[model samples]
Structures are given as C-alpha cells and as structure tokens.
Target: MKHLTRLATAALMTTSLATFAQAGGHANWTSVADQSSIAFGSIKKDTVGEVHHFEDVIGTVSEAGELAVSIQLGSVETYIDIRNERMIEHVFRAADAKATLAGEVDMEELDALGVGETTLTDFEGVLSLGGLEADIEAELLVARLSEDRVLVTTANMIMLSTADLGIDAGIDTLMKLAKLPGITRVTPVTVRMVFEK
Candidate 1:
C-alpha cells in the first residue's frame, strides 16, 4: 500500500509539471517594426493599402497547438480617419463591440512555422463583433518574428457581410450621399496580427 501511494504521488507531480509547460501563458510585445510601411489591402478595393501596426501585442500559447492572439482594435490605419471612425462606430459598432481583435489558432498539421519566413496555413476561430460570435476561416501567411513571436497576415479577403451577423449595412444613407451603388456587399477587411515575446 505504501509503495502504491508513493507511485501515485509521483505521477501526479509529473502531470502537474507537464501542464505548466504546456500552458505557456501570455507574452509581451515590445516593438512593432515598419508600421506605416506594412501594406494591408482590402479585397473589396483590391488595391495595396497601408495599416498601423500594434503598439503593444499580448497573448498566450499552448502545447496542444493553441495560439491566443489579442490585438488593439482602434489601432487600424488605412490612411484615413473618416473611414476609420465610420467603420468603428457605424459599421462595427465599437460601443457594442469592445473586443480588441482576439482569437486562437490551431496549427497541429503544420507542426511549426519558421522564424522570419512567411508560410501559408489555414486557421479557424471565433471573431466576436457587435455582441456576435462569428466563425472565421481563412488562408493565412504566418512568420515567426522570434522564438515566441509570430506574424499572421491575410490580404484582399472578405470578412463576412454585416447582414450575415444580422446587422444593417447602412447603405441607404451611403448611396444617397455618395450617389454610388447600394451596399449589397460589405467591404473586405485586411488584417496583420503580430505577436511578440
């Protein structure tokens, strides 16, 4: 009985250590290089555009191929303030949607991404917006900035329609003012997520 008890205790300790190693917690993002230069283009316009990068990145990682990414939502920059405000307030409803671009990536199939080299992969995760949880899947180009750091990017991709989330596109006002085509489609949003150690 004594020997059995000692063995059980040893097994428990080993399990605890493995769990700690697996759940590697969050890391700080010290710097984001080439902010104004990082070109992020939307699928709707399909033209090369620019975006402001994260001033501070935070997230966690796990051994079971889990990657939690949290980005600052208000930091988006497409070289226009009016467009930004319209998106955050009118389109995205920032008041209702306070989520700061957080999501997780499961990359068990790819094993690992190389540092400083972008590799293509597919990811599926939840995108919370305007009190809605949208399941998103897209092809992504990922590169490791450092050992515990990564950059995830997608270009010219549709981010689902506002109607898909049961939200009005506010196209009536836009069409009347700009004299442009009605908003049958929502604009594609391009994103570059950078995570640092």
Candidate 2:
C-alpha cells in the first residue's frame, strides 16, 4: 500500500509540472502606447504625435485557448500634459467612467504570430472605452522581439462622434484644431503593446 501511494504521488507531480510548463509558455501585455497624429495645414504636415504610456495593464493567456486582456483605468496615456489631464479629469469623467478595455484573442487561430513580423487577419472583439462598449474588428500586427519578448500593434478606427465620450469638441479651440479638413468621419486610434513571457 505504501508503494502504491508513492506511485500515485509521483504521477500527480508529473502532471502538475506539465501544466506549469504549458502555462509558462503564454505571454501577457504589460505595457501599451497610444499615439495619434493630426493634419494642421493645407499641405497635410505630419508632426510627432503625442504618446500616452499605459502601464498596469493586466491580462492572461492560455496556450490553446484565447487571450483575455483587462486594462485598468489608472493605467492610461494621452501624452500631452494638459490634454491628458483634461480628458481624464473632465471629459472622460474618470471619476465615473473608470474605463477598462477587455478582449479575447484566439491563440489557435494566431499560431503564426510571434514568428518575426506577422499581420493577423481581422479579429473581432469588444472594447469598453469612455464608459461605453463597442464592437471592434481590426487587423493585429505582432512581432517576436526576442526569445521572451514580443511587440504587438493594432489600429482601430472609431466612427462615433467625440460627443459620445463627453468630449465637447466645440467647447475649446484646442479641440477644433484637432480636426482635419475634409475628413471628419473616421477617428483612427492605434495601440502598440509590448509583452514578455
């Protein structure tokens, strides 16, 4: 009976180790960069866009299933000193919105990712931003930076008006300056994320 008990314990240990190894192979997004560009003049000059660095990004991944991402409101970036403050404190009503981005990624379908630079096909997910949730479908681009590091980038164009986010575009001249003549329909928001295993 003692020998049988020892055999069962060994088998349990092997199973536990296997599970751990599989879990460790997964990667999670630890940081995010949100940058935007604007057209100022008739010639459409491009300038160095503002960068918002978002840390405290929390998410998990499963080797065979989908990747679930949860980003905390406290972790956000707007780059501009005054703009970031106003957007979070006033426009976003950070006090109420406390926005969080959550989404799922299919690992089985994106197996070709992490092998150099790869552009993923259209991925469908829900984005909860500025106290509202919307369905989003965008192309995902990923690159394996190293044996344990990866870089992921994606661009999502939102068609909703700024008023939806409590942002009064007509209030300040600053907001008006952001407008690009002849293009008032689509707002492209891009995210570049880096992760480590």
Candidate 3:
C-alpha cells in the first residue's frame, strides 16, 4: 500500500488554510511526481471492492506554506484499460480535467523540522472537481526525510462521496453502462506526497 499511501495526501494539503507570503524571498518545495502517489477504494455490489489510483499527481509548496495540488482526472488507473477509459469518459466526463487543491500549512514549523523528524497535524483543504468544491480535512504525518526532502502522508484514511465531488451523475452513468446493480457512492482514499527544496 506504499503507493496507495499517496492518494489522500491531496486531501491533506488542499483545505481552508492560512494565507501568507514571505517578505523577502520564497523558499519552496516542488512536488516529486515520480516519487509521490494517490490511491482510492471503491465498493461495488455492496461487497466487491477494488483499489484504484491516479498516475499523475503534482503540487507545490511555498515559503509561506501555500500548497497547490493537481490530480489529472484522465490519468486514473483502474487496473482494467476499458474501465479506465469508462471512468475517464463516463465518471470524470471531461478532457484535460483536473482535481485541484489549495491551502496553506506551517512552513515555519516545517522549516525548523530536522531531518529524520516527523510531525503530526490536522489540515483542511478545498478539493475541486467537476466544477464542485468540498471542504476536506486530513490528519497527516509529515516527515523530514532529508534537508531538502519531505514526505507527507495521511495519518488516517479519508472518506469522499461522489456527490461531494459532483460526480454522482457520472457514477450513475458508469453503473448503467456496465449493467452494474450497485456501486458505492462513498470511497476511502489515502495519499503520499513528496516534496523537495
């Protein structure tokens, strides 16, 4: 689940966050896309569950702790190619659409964290998709892996509903097209994000 550990990290950094900017210069961390990931789980027929993920995720953090993240809806990987395509067209329903997050954290605290140290905190962020936005909060474990590298992950799994994402219609369409009798509206998500100075 190391890979899936990244799925909800998006929920971690995107929320109602403090806003500020550094005065003189901005120390920032750029997302390491290859090293980061996001994973989500879905239940169908009330019992059959599967885990899926997004292959492309990116974000940035500024000196002032401003964080912005993007998860390409088209990059969803469902293990099955046809299902992936179905999700893209029927569920996501957009070309080049992206789920984005915006919020702020305690950059000053993170800056002071020594390598090999970890901190736990709760954060709230706004996750926007399909023109709908929902407020989300996440408990996170942030570890300073190196002087210039940090690993951010969810301390607990997060729940997100299709309605919250404005994707309920798309989910309905997906079930109808596949002749699926049932699919759960709420999904559990986890995330892991890597940032480097």
Whole-model lDDT per candidate: 0.38, 0.37, 0.65
User: lDDT of candidate 1 vs native?
Assistant: 0.38
Per residue, candidate 2 scores C-alpha lDDT tens digits across 132-188 of: 554445554555665554555543332333433334442233344545342221233
Residue range 1-197, candidate 1, lDDT tens digits: 11111111111212222222222223323223442112222222334333322222333444553444333434444456665555445544462333322334444433344555556665555544446555555565555655655555553353455454434554344334445444444434344444444
Quote the positional error of residue 130 for candidate 3 in Å: 1.7
After superposition, the stretches of candidate 2 with alpha carbons farther than 4 Å from their true spots are 1-59, 63-66, 70-80, 95-97, 112-114, 155-186
Candidate 3 has its poorest 10 consecutive residues by lDDT at 15-24
Model 3, global lDDT: 0.65
Q: Which of candidates 2 and 3 is the stronger one according to lDDT?
A: 3
In angstroms, give how far residue 18 of model 1 lies from its true place: 22
**In TM-score terms, which candidate is top?**
3
Estimate TM-scores for all models: 0.55, 0.53, 0.87
Q: Per-residue lDDT tens digits of candidate 3, residues 42-124?
A: 87888888888888777766666677777777788889888888787877776476777877765554445677877777777
lDDT of 2: 0.37
